[model samples]
Target: MKDWDYGELFEAINESYEEFLANGRGEKFAVARAFNEYANMGKIEDIITGVAIGEILASHDKVFIGYIEGITGWLSEVGKKDLKNELSDGEIENLLGRIATVIRDLRNKPIDSNPVA
Candidate 1:
């Protein structure tokens, strides 16, 4: 039920990205790690984490389809839903659009509103 600030989330993601780069990890892995960390923190729900990951992947032109599948599989494993089944192959644009709609819907909701409600 804690309200999340996207600014703080982005800052954390950026820091993680820098750290991952310093350690020779790729951007995709960094993003995945950040998503996992934030989701596991219990402040952000799985759907929000998925949306964040979708947005990050969409922004990166070099992201491979395998990365998307890996993230979707990870989300499915952790969120306990078959999100990978929900996504169609080569539909990254559609996926990003859906994530954007979710983000907009979240923005319209009250800060105290239950995301899972």
Candidate 2:
């Protein structure tokens, strides 16, 4: 993909994130509008940032999806149990800690993946 695509994705992610933060942290219409705006912008750098942010967010989303699937699978195998007997407080804390570490690592990864500037 083009470098500018990353910028646009990043900007869209940021705009969505901003709306989430401002609007009680749930999906909303404004976030979607922001995404549309970012997609329509033609500047390469803008799009590149959007792509960078989107990549990071997408990675995190994937990780979370995996985690959820794993947890659900485990619970189902164990007779569809809920948190009441599944995870201890320590285990929950550890899982959250690992997620936080992942987020930090993703944030630190270089945005420029292209060979040419």
Q: Provide the overall lDDT of each model, using Cα atoms, as 2-decimal numbers.
A: 0.51, 0.40
Candidate 1 matches the true fold with a TM-score of 0.43
Q: TM-score of each candidate?
A: 0.43, 0.29
Q: What's model 1's lDDT at 59?
A: 58
Write candidate 2's Cα lDDT for 21-95 as tens digits.
577643333333444555544433332333333333434422333323432333223211222233455643543
Candidate 1 local lDDT, 91-111, one digit each (tens): 434444555554444333333
Runs of candidate 1 with Cα error greater than 4 angstroms are: 3-6, 64-98, 101-117
RMSD values, in order shown: 14.2, 17.9
